[model samples]
Target: MNSFFARRYVITGIFITLAFVLLARLFYIQIIDDRYMLFAKNNVVRTQIQYPARGVILDRNGKLLVDNQPVYDVMVTPKAVKPFDTVEFCKLLDIDKPTFDKYFDKAEKYSPSQRSIFQGQLDSTINAKLGERIAEFPGFELVLRSVRSYPDSIAGQFLGYIGQANDATIAKSNGYYHPGDYVGISGVEKSYETELRGQRGVQNILVDSRGREKGRFANGMYDTAAVAGERLKSSLDSRIQKLGEQLMRNKVGSIVAIEPSTGEILCFVSSPTYNPNLMVGREHGNNYMDLLRSPNNPLLVRPIQARYPPGSSFKPLSALIALQEGVITPQTTYNCPGYYVAGNRRVPCFHNERHGTVNLASAVAESCNGYFDMVFERLINRTGPKNTDTSFTSWRTNVAKFGLGAKLDLDLPGETGGLLPKASLYDKWYGRGGWRSSTVISLGIGQGELEATPLQLANIEATIANHGFFYKPHLIKAIGEKQVVKAEFTQKNYVGIEPQYFEPVIDGMQAVVDRGTAVGSRIPGIVMCGKTGTAQIRHQDNSVFVAFAPRDNPKIAIAVVVEGGGQGARWAAPIASFIVEKYLRDSITRRPSGIEPGYFMNASVLPQPAKPKPAPVKAKPDSTAKPAQAALTAGKHKKKKQPVVYAAAILKGDDDE
Candidate 1:
């Protein structure tokens, strides 16, 4: 009896302990951990995203370049959808039944209970028309969103465009963005995406069985308010930008103009550009495909992406390097016999004018090939260890001080550092000590593997304009009300050249506009310093020019490249002159006569006029026309007729080499 009692007591103790542990777990789950309870409640709760308004972009003078317009996205919850009139719904949404079915399947695949976009980016008129009857449909809801709208359609490449985020973008967004979120794709928009894309908010609400909102969940305790994006004040001058586009209408090149003192880009123009509006709306994919298929390659941002040999425009920088190295002085002279001869090789000058005993200033003014060649040879030979790698390394280092062969780290995307040949490359090619100044003399003329983008060339001119220092070039002058210019852009970047060395080069450049090769492009009242370059290409020469205006206190520095445009004086110089005149004088005094507004095949390669399109016929208004239809018709009529524009193509293609 005693043993049986002991065994029974042990069994009772085990049962009691198990019961107590179960009760404790229940208490803990009920009081301490409410996650399961919340999950159960979430079945009836709905969460909606509140997208904030993107910032407006304004030009320097507060002209609205880019703004936002209210757009609507049709959202659907597949589970809430009931058997309804499919044909009627398709007719109301202006979509075919197949599209409706396809979208429904897609939404169901995403999530049957959660809301997904059915059709996005509906315009105001369409959204209004659909909103009146949308309540009759059980599963569909209209969510308001903002899309980019351009007040003035200019600076398509520089301003960039926004589109829906790709899978990669969403994966990297750290839960900030979902599949359908929009993101900036290029240019200023891409650079300042974080500042321009405001913080998102969320709204939680209680919903009934049919997906109807009952009230804010928990009296809106978990709701977060959306914050609007910060405004951007760009450095671009809209008028100047427009003028540049007009001037480059028929060309295949780029123009980069910077304010010399501030390093603010006034205008960035890439030819063969499209309307920024084309990149907006639901049809962006198709329009982008068309642009991509075009032969002109309008998508390429030529200012910083396309590398061209600096050509004669490089002479001023070469002169500065020579002066800084003590290999040449303002009084140094060399003779030009219409050609530069080194051993068996000869480089010919296009000019017939004999520049005999030309000094540094005269050499620049006349663009004396022999003088620069001699200066380069002296620079290489005068180094401590003569005719050695040290000589070439010293020469390259001085050149790099001018911002050559290195990225300038501008805010824009896809900026090329350009090519700067190293001494090692030469040593590898011709073996060390076997090659000397004579073998690399072509570099003196800016022809042998010395390439630079228009932005770098413009910065070089800006450095010269500032008398040996420059601020890094930038696009955004201010962000929000703080005027947040980057410290890098504010600090002066010196070229390691003495300030005194620039005067002779500046004087020669001034003479270039006054009485030299670019004399025809000279402005009447403004004192301009300029250099003309004709970079050799396979089909034809690439015309290039770099200039700074009002020689005393320069306001603007500009670089222009015109592919296959013959001499720099012919196309690039005049284009730069026009840009300068417009900026300083606020009006263009001269327009090049050869250019006219018309359509043409390969406008950049060759000049030709195209027949204009016929005007639209005016239609008589009908009395039964709806208000929306009438408004749309009026809008069509009110579209300011754009002037005839030009299209470009690559001339018989040649390698950039």
Candidate 2:
């Protein structure tokens, strides 16, 4: 009986030990760690994201240039969706059965862990359909997004375009952004991308087993609110932009207008420009590809990129340089017999007329190549080894003050450095600075390799207009959060030209409008001062005009270029004058009725030589011969671009809202 009791006690002890071990193991698994619970939670709970609204762009007058329009994107979680009607969903979305099947298969293949858009560019039609069918489709919801829209139909080139972020961009800015993000590719949008692209927020939601979205995770504790992008108020004026566009409709170059005192760009236009709104959203891909393939490439901002020789207009800068260096005085006279002869090359002045002996002012007004050549030659001497040690170095310093040979560092993008070959540059080419005026005489009249963009040319005129100082060229007047727009640009550059030199040049420029090649652009009742330039290019000529209004206390400074459009006075003058009149005096005074000026609209000024020619008769049924009466009777011409729609309807006024 004693042995049996001992064995029974030992068995009880063993049972107690096993029970304690089992309880300890249960506590370790259930209370000591949370790995399994996290895994379990993840399996049942669903998380989603909602994109925030992007900021808007407005003109200086508080008119909308770009705004966000509500759009929807259809996203699907393959695992979360259940009992989805296949046929009705496909028909209502207007997608084929295969497309629907493909998305479904892709989502399933990627699994519920993947976040991707299944359908994009949902219109109001699709939004309506999805609203009604919301009860039928589970786990598929419309993700609200915004598409960029342009309310105004002007200044498209200056505003630029936007597109999805690429691989390289993602790698660089990945900390702040993600895949499928939109970015400004050009213009002000590109230059101010950081201020324009707002911060993104995220949220993690808890869902029931049935995939119904429950209230926020931890009572809105785990959500990050989005920061909307800043509002940008540009320097562009809607009225000026529209008028400039209309004035440049038949041209093929660019026009840049700025307030002389502030360097604030009022109108920036590149001819053959396209609608910027066409370059956003689902339609962007196709439209962009087409524009890229187009011959004109209307997207390129030519005002800052298209470089051309300054022609006779550059003479004014050269004259000022010479005068400041004391190489020539305002009373200096030169004989002009239509051309300047440099041994073998002959640079011809306009009209082949003889001005006999002329002073500096009349020389500029007449655009005499001979007078400018003498001045440029003298300027080279001042910059070379002399008692004063006048060298190309000092000349370059003076030219730089005029805003040449470098980027303007404007708020706008795509600004190019107008080429100004220095003495060192020539020294590198001519073997150690021994080359003389004979080496680069044409530079006197702004010829040779010297090239400048229209914007730079305009800035030069602005400097001339201001006597010495010019406001830095800028496009954005204000930029910051939507609540408060900050002034982002405030600076000035002063050219070192003496005030005494400015008066003579101003007189010469005014003489140009009074009686010169640019006389046609002279605005009545306005003291207009301007310079006309006709640069020689391969196969044709490019017309250029630069001006600042109301000679004293000027307001608007303008630069105009017409490519393959011969004679500055013929093509560029009228456009510049119209812009000046519209800005200073309210509206244009001269309306050329029954007389349409020759513009870049034509492939050729005339299909044949500008001679009286006979008309052709209608072709009869002739099988063996292709004949125009066996004579060249081609005098007919056709315009390249036509006004298919009315101006008011096509270029609607700004901010309809």
Candidate 3:
């Protein structure tokens, strides 16, 4: 009897221990870890993501620039797919059998049960056809989405575009983004993506065994509504922007204009510009490839990306520095007998003209290379040959105060901080002791390796227009409806030059438009102060100009560059004049003899493609064929760039302009 009681107790104890173990596991699964419960819920619940509509962009004048258009995306759940008539489904989707198979396979690979995008950005016609027959296809559904649309179709590169998110984007989002979502790729679209993309929400609905949607899960307790993105009011003036584009129709450079008081970008144009409409809807990929393959590089944002030597346009800054450093005064005179001779090296003046005696104002008005060269020598060699490096560093630092040799931290992406050489760089090239002011004299004339973008040049002019300070240049002026300006753009940036030092420089600039090299392109009544530059390129010179109007309390500051466009007054000066007139006077009155706006609009400076020669024909030449026509054809074929015509009488004795 004792042995039987012992066996029963031991069996009961073993059973009790087994019961506790099972209870603990059940408790853990129910309360501690909810993965199993989530798994169970996934079998019956369907979660659909609700994407918010992107914000609209407007000009400062309340004109629409970028708006949204409705589109549809076809989503599929591979596991829930019930094979139907493949031919009929393909016909409805406007796709072939092979394409259908490919999309299906891609979807299955991503997730068997989770929804994935099959085809996106379908137009209204496809959306209608597919929507009506969507019920017949068990797993496929249509989801509404929005894509960008440009009404005016300007600023293609500035507004940028959105594209499907890649793996890198997804990994960086930290669960915010999944596959098939879109992200801004560049420009203001990229710079303010977070404010433009908005918040995404989700909806939970009950589902049956075959994945058909039932009523809301738990009376919509788990659902959330999406919030639309904040609207952006950009500082772009549509009128100025449109006119700027028209003026630069056939050019291969950029024009950047800014409001000096506010630093707001009034208008910026990068030539060879394309219609922003090409970046939207079904043909985006093909159109992108076409633009990418263009030889003219219509996609390149030249305002902040293309860097070139500032040339004679850099003289004013050099003059200002010389005055501040006490190396020269406004009355300081330098004699230019065609060339500046330092040891055996001779730096020729503009056209090697003998401007016998010139003060600071006269030197700038005439763009006398020898005058600036001598000024640079004085500034750099101030402390003597033994301390040239120290003086050079001081000059470079002061120049940087004008926002040169560094990136401006522009609101757009892909800005290159233009090349500014340090003392170390010269040390690397010509040892420590070998280089001096005379050795790098080219820098004094704004040649050598120094470079600046058109945007930077525009900013330099704006700084001068404001006397000694400028605001950071920007596009967007307000966020949402609050009309709040960014704090960073409001702060004034001083170039460290005293306000009084800019007077003589302004006087010289006025003389340039009044009776100097740029006289041929001057405005009638406006007190426009300006300077011109002809930067040397490999084949031809790049025309450059910088200017501001009225001389006091200036409204607009501008910079223009025309690649292979000859003298600065030839192409760039007239363009700047036209832009200024449009902004201040609201009309362009004068079409000067050589700098006609109509001529620039119609002329083509782009290089023509090489064509195959026709079979040589030995026929009697017809007398009716004009020599002018024949010459034109030959010139087009033989030369890489077209030669510009000049009225020698009107622009007599003009040098760099």
Best by lDDT: 3
Best by TM-score: 3
RMSD values, in order shown: 13.7, 10.8, 8.1
Candidate 3 has an lDDT of 0.83
Question: Backbone clash tally for model 1?
Answer: 0
User: By TM-score, highest first, what's the ranking?
Assistant: 3, 1, 2
Give lDDT tens digits, candidate 3, residues 96-167.
999998998988988998888898899888888888889999888998889999999998878989988878
* Tens-digit per-residue lDDT, 85-121, candidate 2: 7888888788899999887776667567555567766
- What order do candidates take by lDDT, descending? 3, 1, 2
lDDT of 1 at 421: 89
lDDT of 1 by residue, 1-657 (tens): 999999999999999999999999999888999987878677778888999999899999999999998888899989888778888788878899889989899889878977878888876677778899998888889988898989889999999999878778888989777656788999888999999999999999898765678999999999999998889999999988987888788778889999999999998998877899999887888999999998668899988899998888989899999898888889988877766665344545553345778899988887887788788888877853346588888889888887889999999888889889898987786577656676666578777678999999999999999999989899998998787767777898888988999999999999887777777677778899998887764335677889999899999999999886666776687778888988999976633223322222224443223235334443232211223222221222122221222211111110111
Q: Which residue window of length 10 is worst by lDDT in model 1?
A: 648-657
- TM-score winner between candidates 2 and 3: 3
TM-score of each: 0.87, 0.80, 0.92
Clashes of each: 0, 2, 0
lDDT of 2 at 631: 15
User: Candidate 2, which segments miss by more than 4 Å at Cα?
Assistant: 1-48, 76-91, 95-112, 134-139, 383-390, 424-430, 481-488, 591-657
